[model samples]
Target: MADEKRRPRPAAQYGPTAALVARNVERLRKTRNLTIYSLSAELGKAGRPITPSAIAKIEKMQRQVNVDDLLALAVVFGVSPAALLLPLEDSPRHTAEITGAGAVPADSAWAWASNKRPLKFPPGEQRTAEMEYALASLPPNAREARQHPAGRAIEAAYEDVTRVIVRAAWSVEGDEHEFIDALDQARASLERTLAELGRLAVEHEELVRLRDGVPREGSD
Candidate 1:
């Protein structure tokens, strides 16, 4: 029984998410120019050692990735665990096969994996109280602010500005024109983000007033 448990199962027996993880692990390893041996070494340094043979089996979908393996791999690859579980392609037209969820749009799969949305909605297409509680239970960084559309726009704008600033700081000689253009773009993005923030602040204040039963200005 132990030998049978140790043996590699047929590909059909592996879950869809497991197959996706195997493919992504191999892809990310090759993209980073690391061999299985090197990845194994890195994993060992990360305190979750897997032999090269086991890593090879994992890449080939002959072995299952446990939760600890998933977390360790994410750390080694410098990515979130969701990145390994979801499809690399984010095209809405394409589909990803999830184990219990069956096939869902690739983008939706990514959103669900990243906690931007639920994997499946309740009947009537409304979020349940449990779902709301689950979302509320997330850390502040992982909650609605980061997942909401407006918040995402703000975050994206910040990233754009940060990217430009980094490029400018490390800019090579004779790249003045390119750096200036990037600075202009960053400035525009920052302005837009600021405007959005101001709008949200006003909206929040109004909500507070309403919740406190305060009358609107110039109203009876």
Candidate 2:
């Protein structure tokens, strides 16, 4: 075998990383339609005092971000603190769901019911955990398409399959067996939605890769 020397890969510049994070901060600020003044004010409200010019400097990559500043910025942006620091770009979140009875009319009654009475979920089951499971399966960047804006639409779809609307209406009159069936259906729907979300996440991997200037190796 012939001895061959391997070529060394060039290191990426820090300018890009700083510039990218700055660009992201500015993009988020602009997309949210926030003025530098407003952003500064908000940071103040979050108990961090910093000038808008400081934010601008950070965005221009002229200044570095401290832990408190980063945390303050994250609070203003409604994103995770680590997200602001990562070299990769993050996709926009899902659409916002309007909370109203028309969307989930059956459960709508409970909106006020819980206000009047103490509600207790059954043993060996949890609401937040189960819902989080469904949510966790979703893309880190949820489908922001018209059909499924907020990730809640996925839950809404599951509700449809489980006859959540009907179940809520009939639950008072129906037997435990009927309610159980409805929950079963809901679970199945959640399972299916989770699978779909997983697929989208894999597809979204390309978007993240692109940010790092990583090319698709197989494409000639």
Q: TM-score of each candidate?
A: 0.62, 0.34
lDDT of each: 0.81, 0.59
**Cα distance off (Å), candidate 2, residue 94:** 21
Give me the displacement of residue 116 in model 2, in angstroms: 40
Worst 10 residues of 2 by lDDT: 89-98
Residue 135 lDDT (model 2): 54
Per-residue CA lDDT of model 2 for 131-167, tens digit only, reads: 4443534344442331242345475554455465556
Lowest-sum lDDT 10-residue window in model 1: 125-134
Best by TM-score: 1
lDDT of 1 at 58: 95
Reference-based lDDT, residue 136, model 1: 63
lDDT of 2: 0.59
Candidate 2: Cα lDDT at 137: 41
